[model samples]
Target chain A: MDLSAINPTLLLASLMVAATPLLLAAIGELVVERAGVLNLGVEGMMITGAICGFAIAVNTGSPILGLVAAALGGAVLSLLFAALTQYALANQVASGLALTLFGLGLSALIGQGYQGIKPPSFPKADIPLLSDIPFLGGVLFRHDFVVYLAIALTAVVWWVLKYSRIGLVLRAVGENHDAAHALGYKVVRIRVAAICFGGACAGLGGAYISLIRVPQWTEGMTAGIGWIALALVVFASWKPWRAMLGAYLFGGITVLQLNLQAAGVAIPVEYLAMSPYLITIIVLVIMSADKSRAPAALGRSFHASQ
Target chain B: MKLSKLLATAAVALGMATGAMAEDKTKVGFVFVGPIGDGGWTYEHNKGRLAVEQEFGDKVETVFVESVPEGPDAERVMTQMALEGADLIFTTSFGYMDPTINVAAKFPNVKFEHATGYKRADNVSTYSARFYEGRAIQGHIAGKMTKSNIVGYIGSYPIPEVIRGINSAFSHARKANPDVQFKIVWAYTWFDPAKEAEAAKVLIEQGADIILQHTDSTAPQAAAQEAGNVYTFGQASDMAEYGPKPRISSIIDDWAPYYIARTRAVMDGTWTSTDTWDGIGPGMVGIGEISSEVPADVKAEALALKDAIAKGEYHPFTGPLNKQDGSAWLAAGETADDGTLLGMNFYVEGIEGTIPQ
Candidate 1:
């Protein structure tokens, strides 16, 4: 292996940038799973956000506004899932799958006109003093704002989930919906709000990809990142900080594997190509004991006895 | 029920009217593996479809469905097209091999053409361009132009076709610049922009000054453009929009002439099941404009090599070549046969890494 082909600083920097999308999506999915909901529609909502964000950014010429539109579009799409499950009392699994299929088709239709068009470039946020530190500067200080925002959001989510009363109520609702409804919590309403929040986060993640990462619009551009994010939530034991850790770990492997291939590593290329997914699942399986750590009422729909 | 019957009768009447007006014309159908605007492989095929329409004028009606996944879904699409009265159908992807054969079995009267695949039946014929011939020219230019001696190749898959391309590129590159090294990254996808761009960046970070891709997409070219001074060559189609600098040249798949000829054969009822593999000389493959950004001497040399390959005076896989293990693959002055080239799986000498079975 060529040793000089690998660099610690650049590796760490790309690790953070690569993890941002997964982190954003995982954290949102974590919140949804914690609230006793499993929205497979994360893929659908993410792709909808991708195209909507791309079209708006290209038309309005503002990446910020494009992100906002992406969130709005995602929330609106997820709202479809939320309504079908909460009000109409449909099968959660089927509704989530339908949401994904619908989102894919709708996004393709909307993205038809925006294909092959490049959007405005996103600039990295250079923090003043910290950016000057030799090794740390290159690793932490030279990334787009979304990278920092994703980290900050992780911290905020961790705190809110651990210490806030809202967190307690959410946990209570998720553990036993009927018990919470008996005590006064509104099950459907809280779950709906949580789904919207998850949708918004997933949308931002998709927008980050379209507006800054690849910085162009193409159909099905999310490319199953949403599905990976869904897995990260379970691997994170439904915890936000744990999910962030998982995202970084998977991102690290992704970057490392590319480096290995570029360095002409003698390993089989097929194994190197699949290392990201294989390694992520293997590591996460070891980190999480599995099943026992998930929310008690996860994926179970709740209805009060009227 | 009454409205449905009326609608059905009107549709039949419309079909009858069109059939009577163009009774001698042919109905052709195209199945694409990606969007028509992908700016790469699928785009070139779609252009050929349009060319068929133009060549036949009112004598032919063409229909196409894009972004069709390979496998069972492809079979269903082919069946639907055959049912819709398509006289000839072109399935343009290697993965569509079995599906085309399966569909062609049920529709005994419909003609099927599969690209880049070897499978064939009485109704199904196999055809592919000699893309390696074009890659040799690209490898020559890349080898001469690179300052770091590391030419990055983004491969879509480890199949025989892709393997052939990588081998051809490396062969000519080492011939032009003995110090040249190849760094290959397989994206495992035919057209994913993000993954392609990411591969380009990694290659650049590893000190590659010239980028070559077997995958379809303009992302690598865009990535090269973003990284100033880095060079790239377009794949499958002429992506001149990124021209004059980053895209110094391209390997264009000229399928129009082939498509027109096949359609004409169908009209004349002379079409029979056969395998056709033609390259630059047959106009099925073309080396796009070598932009002025390339040094004049290098451009002329690349064009000369292209001419030699096209004129059959030289073969890209000529011997004096050894396998990656230094095993003698071909004796000096020996050329590879179609069977060996069609199933090429090993890297030529000087390239590193296993094929990753």
Candidate 2:
């Protein structure tokens, strides 16, 4: 094994890109859960976004427009969930599962002609001076614009959830929907908005994977990353910063394990292959040691005068 | 919900589906684990299916379902095909081993051919190409082309098939350049593009100048292109689209000849269960074009190795090789037996890391 082969700067730098998708999805989910709605369709929304973003990027020759289209696509799909759960009063869990299935099938159908077609490359934003600094420059400044946006979104989510008046109302709505409704809050409207935001964020995550990560269009390209985002929300105990921490932790382990293998570390292949998931499980068990602290009405559908 | 009622309903559904499709032709079916547009392993298999259609224009009817998962879902798809009067079926992918046997048991009158699987029954015949033959040529090129003497290998899994390819490539690479080193990264997935690309990036970061992948994705080729100066070979299909650079050569799997012959055997009522393992000599494994980007000397050497292998004048795993712990595995001039190679689980000499239990 080549111990000297592992470069800390490259490791930390790549992990930032690796963590962006999960962080985007988790931060959005944190907001949705805080506003008293539980959506299990994150996987579906992500895959749909993957195709929508891919199609737009390939057609328009603009990754920026593609990313915007991805968010809109995700929001549109989430509105369908909103219609089913809010208007039809269907079981939120069942509707969410259906959404995921529908999204996977829908994305595959949309991605039929786009398979194997590469999207135009999005250039990295290597900030001047800062990016030239030895180790920290590579770690912090030499990344695509999305990396900075992911971190900024995390900080904004954490701050708004903990400090703002809107944050207080969201937390109140999650704590007890009946009381929030009696307190003159339009619980359904706020929950729908939160769900749409969550969908858009999840879409952005899926789009990041298709447009930048793999940078190609293929059926089921998102794989099971949406499920991981869902698991991260629970692992974070409904906190935004903790979700970022979880994303980076998993991302760091993934990049580190790959480096270890490339360095010819003598660890058995099976263990190294599973190291990322194993570490995540250990951290998740520790987090679950405390009381869940989930939103009181997290997965409950709100109905007035029930 | 009674068994009899279920059977009756299934029979009626099957009759409705096939009655409209049945014609005076041999019914052939294929099951693929990936989309036909995968541009790699499944793409080659689908090409074989297309060849079958071409071989028997008006006398054969071809049908296939893509992206069949390698478990119970595969069993269901196969059983459905049998019920729909598919007289012959080909299930591709190693994970379909047991499922093929299971589906064959109930469809004894119908013939089944499974690729890269070992198990066989009365109605099931197992067939796989000797892919290591191609890996040997790839190794020679990798060895000669490396400026850094380090070749990164992206392994899909630790199964015998993948492990065998690693040993074959490493042995030949080391033969050409004694100082050469191979670093293996097992992605444990067959078709996840993002994961495969990340693996390639990690290997590139670690000083790998020539990347070889057993995983079925164009991601590594893309990663190698972006990194520039890195060389790669396509795994299963000729990914010539990368052209002239990263993908300098490839191992093209040609299943058409065997598929057509097997279908002919079925049409003639001579089909039976058997194990078929053919290589470059028998035209199952094809060496793709050695791009001009590769140095002339390296390309000629690689082609020489390919010709020797195809003519059966040489074996990729020849003698004087030791196990990972330096134990004597093969004496000088002693060729490995088919049994040992089929179940190969250990690394050859000078290779690092375990096969992963």
Candidate 3:
């Protein structure tokens, strides 16, 4: 095995690209869960966004418009979930699961004639002087807009949850919806807005995949990344920045495993293939420890009377 | 009492008449491992299904379940089809081998045909295309075209079918260019576009100018196109859209003829448990149009090689090859038998890395 064939710079560069979608999706879910709502429909929302963005991009010849449509599509789908869990007092778990199934079917329907078609190219952002820096530039400065956006979004999420009043209210609702309601906050309205934001973020993440990563549309293209993002959210202790770390670690391992296989490393292929999930779980589980926990009111329905 | 008895007799007669009508139309069910629009493996299989419908018209009724997982779910689908009175079922995936057999045993009246598999029952038949023949030609082109001397192969699994293609491609590539090295990466999936694209990009980054894939997606072709100067081959289906550059040619699986013939066999009551492994000779495997990007001489040679294989003048696995361990596998000028090729487990000499166990 020629280990030298695996370039660390390229590996880290691609890892950023690979982790962007997961980071986007997880960050959105973090906000939703922080608002005391658990949406298990990340996969569905991601796939729905994938096709929506792909279709619009293919037609409009603008990836930016496609990204917008994807976010809107995801938010529209989440509205259904909000209506079910928030207004109708449906079970959060069942509604989220149903949302995923509905999204899969809906995307497949919308994606009928869109298969095998490539979306318009999204150019890389080679930061002026920063991109020219030796090794770090190659690894960190050379990526498309979505990668930076995902990281920025993570930071924004962290700041909001840490210091912003809106973040405080969202967390309050998540921690104790009844108490937040008593504090003169429109609990349902807050949760609905948070859910929509999560949906939009998930949509952007899905579009990042279709518009940049794979750059094509295929059924079930998102695969199980949605589920992995969900797991990452819990493992990162619902911390936005840790979710970013967890995403890169997972993405790094995934790309690294493929690199190892390509370089014909002596390790068994199966173990290397599964290392992304295994290692991410181990590291995140260790990082989380007993210091963090799920929001107390998560997955619970809150009505004014109840 | 007499009027009630008369009404019951009439009801029984109507049920018998409808049953007879239902029996007249042969119901054929298909279970696919990926979506029909995958633009690759399942796409070809679905075309065959459509051909079956076109050939029989009103004489046949076809039902298909796309992207069915190959496990208990496959068995459930087959059983459901049988219960729905399907006379024949085609499970188009190697993973469905055992499920097809088990399902066939339950519904003795239903004829089952499993693709790219070895298992068979009294009512189940196994059929697969000899895709390695096309791989040999691709290897030659890749060998002649690559400047980097590093050929990357994206494998779907460690199955014998994939291993055979890798070995065949590598050997012919070596023959054409002695310095050529095969760098293989197993994606372990049949149709994950994102993962397949990632695998392709990784290979390109590692200096492999030529990318070969066993997975069922056009994502690799897109990746190769985006990389500029990197070449890839269309797999299972004719991905002509990416052609004239990255996709110089393709190995197209034409199952329409076989599917129609098998359906006709069931119609004729001649369907029996059989193993059909056909290559270019019978047109089961077709080498797609070699684009103008391939040089005239290389294209001519690739065509000549295809013709030779089709005419049975050449066997891809013939002669003087050694196992990866340097142990001799085939004697000089000796051709590989079907039994060994069907169960191929080890890599041939000069191809680095062990097949994932």
Q: Pick the candidate with the highest lDDT.
A: 3
For candidate 2, report its TM-score: 0.90
DockQ-sorted candidate list, best first: 3, 2, 1
Per-model i-RMS in Å?
1.9, 1.8, 1.1
DockQ of all candidate complexes: 0.42, 0.53, 0.63
Q: What does candidate 3's lDDT look like per residue over B183-227, in tens digits?
A: 999998898888999999999999999999999988899889888
TM-score of chain B of 2: 0.94
Angstrom error of the Cα, residue A230, model 2: value is 1.7
- Candidate 1: the clashing residue pairs are none
Please give the lDDT score at residue A109 for candidate 3. Answer: 94
User: Model 3, stretches more than 4 Å misplaced?
Assistant: B1-23
- Give the B-chain TM-score of model 3: 0.94
lDDT of 2 by residue, B201-313 (tens): 89989999999998777878878887889999987999887777878999999999999999999989999899999999998998889998888888888888888998999
Could you tell me how far off, in angstroms, the CA of residue A250 lies in candidate 2 after the best superposition? 1.2
TM-score of each: 0.89, 0.90, 0.94
Error of 2 at A101 (Å): 3.7
User: Model 2, which residues run further than 4 Å from truth?
Assistant: A112-117, A172-179, A182-184, A302-306, B1-29, B53-89, B106-110
Best candidate (score: DockQ): 3
Q: Is candidate 1 or candidate 3 better by DockQ?
A: 3
Report candidate 2's fraction of native contacts. Answer: 0.48
* TM-score (C-alpha, index-matched) for candidate 1: 0.89
